[model samples]
Target: MKKIHNYFAIVFLFFALHAVGQTKDNKWTFGMDIAWVSYSEADKIAVGGKFINQTPRFSLAKYMFKNVVFVGSVSTAIGDNQTYTTFDGAARYDFGTSQNKVVPYALIGGSFINARILTPTLNFGAGSTLWFSPKYGLNVQLLYKFSEERFSSQRSHIMPSIGLVYSFGARDMNPRIWSSTR
Candidate 1:
């Protein structure tokens, strides 16, 4: 497991650096997701906690490849103490290219979980982004989180979120509404 973690980390770093090299200009997105974290079976990384936590997740993403984007997010509770807070970093590989109005992707990432105590989490999931225009749209995601510590307060869980996404940069050569009439 240690070796696997190391390999995954190395691969993640390689792709992240490579993407920066390959990128030319404008491909950045900012998003806010309303996340509902469903605590799975007992010991779902929170020790006897099996419930759902609703949170607002803020994220920043950069498109590195034609099909890959790296996202970093921070989430916390609003008006609740039992909710979990997390800082996450993930890479998403979209099935559709940049031109599509809707793009679905697979995700893998790690998280620093703060429930009762701090723990590390490995997460995998799928999501999609729906673009209304080149600038704005909706984003949704579902993730399965696995806690690293077995004897701690950290437990496993499923998280799903929906939110708005805004894109900025030079994705289109000419940033204008696609209309025929002048």
Candidate 2:
């Protein structure tokens, strides 16, 4: 498990750095998400019950390669007796277009997740996120988390999320760094 985590870390970092070099600037995406999260652990103290989850996310992207963009996102939520926060940096490939009025994208990235339990005796968590965004329409996702607790075992979680997105300066593959100059 450690090895797999390390490998994923390396790959995600590589892509994230590559994305930084490829983007131009002045593009941003903002969204909000509602989800359901379930927690079940053999050690009762490690996880709690299922709960409604809602996250508001914002991402900034810059064009680099033809269809590629570098992205940074942050999210926060309260759920299942805990409060969660996440930060991510990734590379994305845009498939559809602004002209078509529907934008589709795929992203692979690395994230830091922190969870704090409200109950004093329960455990909190800190972990990484390796996720893929198959559909960017309406800013919804099948959210996935690969997480580990300080005293508990590692786990993979999948949840359905629905959100709204507002994207700005999404014109070309490599949008001008300063539209004013253009």
The best candidate by lDDT is 1
Looking at candidate 2, the ten consecutive residues that score lowest on lDDT are 119-128
lDDT of 2 by residue, 61-174 (tens): 566656666766665664334565556676666542322333455666665656553211112222111112211225455545555455243234554556544344323332
Give the worst 10-residue stretch by lDDT in candidate 1.
15-24
The lDDT values for all models are 0.69, 0.45
- Clashing residue pairs in candidate 2 are 22-64, 23-63
CA RMSD of each candidate after superposition: 10.9, 13.7
Q: Which stretches of candidate 1 lie over 4 Å from their true place?
A: 1-25, 44-48, 149-151, 170-182
lDDT of 1 by residue, 1-182 (tens): 45744663565445434431112255677776678777656554445456655555778888787678899998775555475789999998876445555667899999988777788999999988766665666888998988765637677778899987766643442233343122
Cα-based RMSD of candidate 1 = 10.9
Overall local distance difference test of candidate 2: 0.45
Candidate 1 lDDT for residue 107: 94
Predicted structure with the largest TM-score when compared to the true one = 1
**Candidate 2 ranges with C-alpha deviation above 4 Å:** 1-26, 35-45, 96-99, 116-137, 148-154, 170-182
